[model samples]
Target: MVKEIVLSPDEIIEYIRTEVKVNDVLEIAYNRVFAPGIVLGITPEDEETGEGLRVGLALTGEILSDYVEVDFHRLKDDILEIRHNPTGDKDDEEHLIIIEAEMFDNMDQK
Candidate 1:
C-alpha cells in the first residue's frame, strides 16, 4: 500500500531540515509551473539571514533553465501544496517532495 502525506508549510520546513538529503527529488511549484529537480545540497538555516533552509536544486526541465536556491522562508509564504514520498517506494521513502500547483491563489495575499 502507498501512503500520501500532505504537509503544511511549517512541517515542510522541518521535514527538509531533518529528513531531506542530497540527490533527493523535489518538484517545486513556481508561477503555476511545477519544476522537477534533484537536490544538489542543503544549507542550514542562518540566524542572521533568517532564510530558514536554503535548498540548492538542479532543475531537470527547460522551465527553470539552471540551478536555483530555494529559500524555505519564501516557500513558507508561497507554497501551494506539498506531498512527501509521492512515489511510495519503500526503499526511497521520504525522498520525494512534490510541490503541486495553485492550492492557494497567493498565500501572501491572504
Candidate 2:
C-alpha cells in the first residue's frame, strides 16, 4: 500500500521542485477535460487544513499570471499529468479555467 502523508504548501513546492524543473510541460485537468500549461511558480495559501498551494502556469514566457489554489485534500488521488513541451503549431493550444461563484455557495451540500 502507498503511504499517505499530508504536506504543507511549502513542502509541496519542494516536492514538485525535486521532480519537475521550471518550464516543464504539464496538463491540468478538471471534470474530465485537460488543458496544456507550463509551470511558472508555486506559492502558499491559507486553508483550514493549512496545506493549500497556489500553482502558477502560462502558455508562454510573455504571460504568466494564470493561477490556481487547490486544497491539499483534493490531491489525494493524483498530483499532475506531465507531458513534453509542444512544438510547431501544436504549441498554440491554451485553456483558461474559471470557477463559478455558485460552486462555493453549495459546498455544504456535498
Candidate 3:
C-alpha cells in the first residue's frame, strides 16, 4: 500500500493543480476534508483553525449529481471524517471534491 502523507491546506491545493491523483478527495485539512480545485479559498471565519471534519465525501451515487461545493471555512481540529456525494452536471460523471463542515474547538478556548 502507498503511504499517505499529510499536507498543509496550501500545499494540498497546489498539489491538486500539479500532482493530484484523486480528484474526489484532495487532502485532509486541519480536520475537515478538502476538494482542492473545488473551493475558491478558506472562509474568513475559519481564521482560528480549530474545527472537526468527520467527512467530505464525493458523491458517486446516481441520485446526487449536480452537487458541487467545497467549503474550507470549517477546518479546525486535526481529525476530519469526510463524506460527500457525487459531482457532475448531468453530463459529466466525474466526481470531484465537495465542501464539508464539522466541529470546531474555538468555543472550548480559555
12-71: candidate 1 lDDT, tens digit per residue: 788778877787667666456565667889999888866658888787776555888888
Error of 2 at 29 (Å): 3.3
Q: Which stretches of candidate 3 lie over 4 Å from their true place?
A: 21-58, 69-110
lDDT of 1 at 1: 34
lDDT of 2: 0.43
Q: Model 3's lDDT to the true fold?
A: 0.35
Clash count (model 3, backbone only): 21
Window of ten residues with lowest summed lDDT in model 1: 82-91
lDDT for 28 in candidate 2 is 47
Computed on alpha carbons, the lDDT of every model, listed in order, comes to 0.65, 0.43, 0.35
Q: What are the TM-scores, per candidate, against the unseen true structure?
A: 0.66, 0.38, 0.30
Tell me the tens digit of each residue's lDDT in model 2 across 8-103: 433544555454435655554444535555666655546566555545566543345454443333552343333333322224344212211122
Pairs of residues at least 3 apart in sequence or in different chains that clash in candidate 2:
none
Name the top lDDT candidate. 1
| lDDT of candidate 3 over 68-98, digit per residue (tens) | 3343323333435332213413223244343
